[model samples]
Target: MRRFTRPKVIPLLAKKPPSQLPHLSPIPNPSLPQPPQNPSPPSPILTLSHTQNHTHLLTFIKTHIKNPPLTPKTLLHFLKSKLHHHPTFTHLDFHVFNWASTVDSYRHDHSTFEWMVCSLANTARFSELGCLLSFIVANPCPCSDGIFSCPRTEPIFRFAISAYCRVGRLDDAVRAFDSMRKLIDGKASVVVYNILINGFVKCGEHDKALWFYERMVRDRVKGDVFTFNILISSYCRNSQFGLALELFKDMRGKGCSPNVVSFNTLIKGFFREGKFEDGIEMAYEMIEFGCEFSSVTCEILVDGLCREGQVEEACELLIDFSRKGVVPRGYDYYGLVEVLCRKGNSERALEVVDELWRMRNVPSLIACTTLVEGLRRSARIDEALEVMGRMLEVDMVPDIVTFNCLLQDLCNLGRTEEADNLSLLSSTKGLELDATAYTILASGYSREGKKKEGKVVVDEMLDMGFIPDLATYNRLANG
Candidate 1:
């Protein structure tokens, strides 16, 4: 079967209209509020342009009408499939929709109304969207004429309301919501109320969000967990921790289970209030409630406690969490290690790394590097070497600069053979060895008077394409 390809649309200014295969038109029209009926006459240029657009639309529609009378579905298909993608014609969607409304025979259904609403909304055309909403409100979907309201009407306005809220047009969003509630058969869904509340919250209108929440309750609408979460976070943001606590309790009484977000919010609120114990206590409560700990939860706990100079407590908490296997594997615990090392407590940092590593919670490369540098600074070479080996086994290699520094340390202490082994291991483990790495090892072998080993190191450097100069290579290689 041959595939049919849509022809490129002709430019609006082009005199010659393109030859058309088949296209589209409309069926019925709904009278709507455009400009006043007895308005000023159009200019000749706009008149000509309008006539050309109308002629183009009519030509396409007449050619492509599959059934006898074009329905809203067919019209919508033409809008999306044909005109919507066109550069010049795309902006004329509303005009074409108006043209459809002019057709006395075809009445639009929800499909057409929703398409236009979403199209206007997605383009951030609020002024035009407001007019479209007025049109939708004045001409309710035919389905609303039945006993039950149009199920789709609320969703369309819901989308529009969200769009309005996104642009901080809270007033317009409320107006749209009120209009939607009137059109729908019953109370609006809790989700619509939540959107309005969230919109207010996002605009820093916490009081308004609360007022709206009260209105929702009085309207006999029930908020789900998501609704409670939004309000809870808003309360915390407003510095109403006491009220936030009360609302949290009410949430439990209402059988809305607090998720990780709920806990994280309150925990952060506690930290802000300088209630360290309370913050940590609530984290423990999260465990009791069987809520999975999020990475943010750990951050709040670690950062909060450490900020208050309770670094050891933070360390204990992380280790405890790891023992219970409750720690997120992706968490590196680098912050705690850095804090510990910064406080001149590298001993504790070492223990923390060792304990966590033994529990199979792998340290990130930075964590391993940090821990290694801390140990080396405190001259704990044995422990640093142990950590390095374990990290290399897991394919967690540090950058070459760090490896070279550690090699220099080991070689200065007469452990060049071990440094040589480390260099070899890091190379095989994907850490590219620079000339300095082999030079350090070569110098160490020279100091130890191991000419065979020194020459061997020089030979390995040559094989790896790292020759400094013939004289330098000869002096070191002959040593």
Candidate 2:
């Protein structure tokens, strides 16, 4: 206790060591030996897993089945439960099912199997669908009497064959029909042959579609309204409007009433060949035949009339149709406006534009530009400016075309000051003044001997990233 008291009395002073601390010695590196590397294990052959392959098989089946229509989700669930974890079940499962059930289920349920067959054929997977037909040929489904029936005996098979033909898979479709014929002991029905003919027509294989028609007549497949409609539509689509008209006559001669679709197709075909009057006549004929004119028919009439510079007639027709409570749906009034404007009748065109606006449909940028250009060309500069202002007021920003039109009009009218002001406004609004607009302004300035002003405009144009064209450059150089 006395020593501690004395140490405390010394103010607890500690001794100072050298400036640097002692360093520890480094350890020696150990020499570690490397182990021998073993050869890599052989990679497994990467076939699809059972679940993945089953999913693909189900997808294939669902794709083929459209009628007794099983969706992909339903088919996947069915396969998961029915073919569970099976490796060999590819797209051929449904094919086997269709064939086997056909023979066994004739007495149990004929309609259900037929429905399945029709559904399978409508699926775009022709190759997988062909598998079903092949299975049917090998193992024919039975008839109502419980006797094994040939594939041709089933109407569903015929429907499938026809669907294939419609989609331009004519060769495979023909093979299916042939298989059915052999199975049915050469007793193919008129309905089956008609389907094949219709398929060819639908696929734009007009020649083949027509060939099938001839074959049907040769085989005495009863020509009905359905048969005529298909062939007529095929001719119309193939630009053979005259042939389509002839077919229409033939149908009427055979006491088959021409349906609205037939009339519409003919009218559209005529319009396609630039025969507006003929198309209009067909529309009239549709009404005479007690076939009500659809909106599509009205549109065809309107488009044809407008294209032929008879926009006044088109507008009258539209107004008349609207008054008659037959407002044409999906009809473009913009096209009408364009045709009218192109004919140098922008005032009449504006009437159509106003009509569309009232109907809550604004004309497109193209129609707006066309109208403005027409107004300018007619020396109606003030009216064109008013239209541009109205467009902007409607929150329609002026595109490059709008600016070009306005600039040209202003320059043409010797209003270069206004044009220059407008160009500045365009730049401030982030609207790029194109080379045409610049050239117009530059030429206007140069023509008045305002060389300095023209050079300033040229510099501004270059600053705005527009390279003046040859005319603009020559004018600046000559001036």
Candidate 3:
């Protein structure tokens, strides 16, 4: 579920951008692409002069290109800064890109080619993107003028293929890929194959993804870990967990080691089919394979077992993970504690938190608070007090309400001395105390018959404005 964040692009031309732009040599008289067959089709570029906006575009192009025989670099700059970045003329980039080819000496290099492609793809202008790709095929880069094809060519098509895949235009993607394979000097990179496979999978064409993966293999392209991960996920999604597992084994057999994601996906797949034991085993295997844990990995294991009413087993597995020292520092165990507490196994929850904390897997603040409340409800005042102290030692203070409640619990258990020490310690850790905190401590000391201690707290309370009225102040100090 990795979300792809497209880089911020120009404002308007995202409609259907090319992963690259046109260079002149491909086909003689390469006409502009026909607009898509939908309502409100874009005005054909040749017809731009008929519209009011075309006047501005024409003027801007004329103004920017006073010098003849435009170089690709200069033209790219003008297209990007003068038009791409223009507030009013941003969508007019393709027009100028085409117009630049008409210049006698101007030739589109990889730079303008890439810019135009990205612009078309960003705008989701697939049909135009296809034409642009065709134009590139007809007029290969100047570097390809010698025996070798342009190195930049594959990258441009790769970007274009990914863009096509993004829009579910797999045919266009495959067409672009085919054209690229014909032009590239050697085998298509595994990366290119992966994009198409992943694109097919994302578009819900599992069988096609598999077909493409097989083709990639036949091409003798060494499939990387990502290749296996995608197909593994695809098989799992198709209810072919057996195949997913087979691929998992095949992945390792091929000297492509499984990473955390590899294990996590299968573990999750196992759990999705209610194969809890298998899921847990997959997690342990992750550790054995030297793949470090992600927080989500732990979450999946814990949540899966808990769903099956194996809460204690979940607890043991996590403790084992913590002891194994594979738990990522970013992995938070709050949900486990919260679940255990809600299940009335507060002691087990406390044990889990304590064991992990002892190993320096500091429980998040909410986990500490939840565990403290769980302990409080069970009348485990001593453990609650100790948990509170540990939280402060780590500079994690509870909310004031929880803090006061714990203090009150300590006093109620005749541990007022411990309560007072805690109050002082907590303040140093940036735990703000209120009238209720001081009042609770003062009352605790009064019950313990230590007037001197009680008076000290009362005086402090008065200085801090907790003793609001004269009568309350006198009552607190004299108690």
Clash tally, candidates in order? 9, 6, 23
Q: What Cα-based lDDT does every candidate model obtain?
A: 0.81, 0.63, 0.82
Which residue runs of candidate 1 sit more than 4 Å off their true CA positions?
1-68
As a whole number from 0 to 100, the lDDT of residue 241 in candidate 1 is 90
Tens-place lDDT digits, model 3, residues 326-433 = 878867888889988887778999899888887889989898999999888888888888888888887897899999999898889888988899889999999889
TM-score of 2: 0.50
lDDT string for model 1 (1-479, tens) is 21133222221121222233222232222353355445653311111144455567666656666464558888999888987887767876776666566454456779998998899899887877887787677667777665677789989999999999998999999999999977787789999999999999999999999999999999999888888888988988888898998889999999889999999999999999998889889989999899999889999999889988899899899999888878877877898888887777788998988888888878788988888888888888888888888889999888888789899999999999999999889879999898899889999998888889989999988888888679877977976
**Residue 6, model 3: Cα distance from true site in angstroms:** 36
Which residue pairs does candidate 1 place in steric collision?
23-64, 24-60, 24-61, 25-61, 27-106, 28-106, 29-101, 29-103, 30-101
Q: lDDT tens string, model 2, 1-479?
A: 01111111110112123332111111122344535544864211112334455456545544554444233344445444544345575334343343223221112133434544664665466654675566455444434223335343547667777677667788888888888765554446767777788777766678987887888787766688778878878887777778888989988998888777788788888878887777777766665567776767776788778767677889876655554444544455667777777778888877766666556556666777778887877777887886776676566667887678788778777888788887776566567667788788889887777878888888777677675476755555455
Residue 465 error, candidate 2, Å: 34
TM-score top scorer: 1
Which residue pairs clash in candidate 2?
66-119, 67-119, 102-141, 103-141, 103-142, 166-199
**C-alpha lDDT (0 to 100) for residue 313 of candidate 2:** 84
TM-score of 1: 0.86
**Candidates in descending lDDT order:** 3, 1, 2
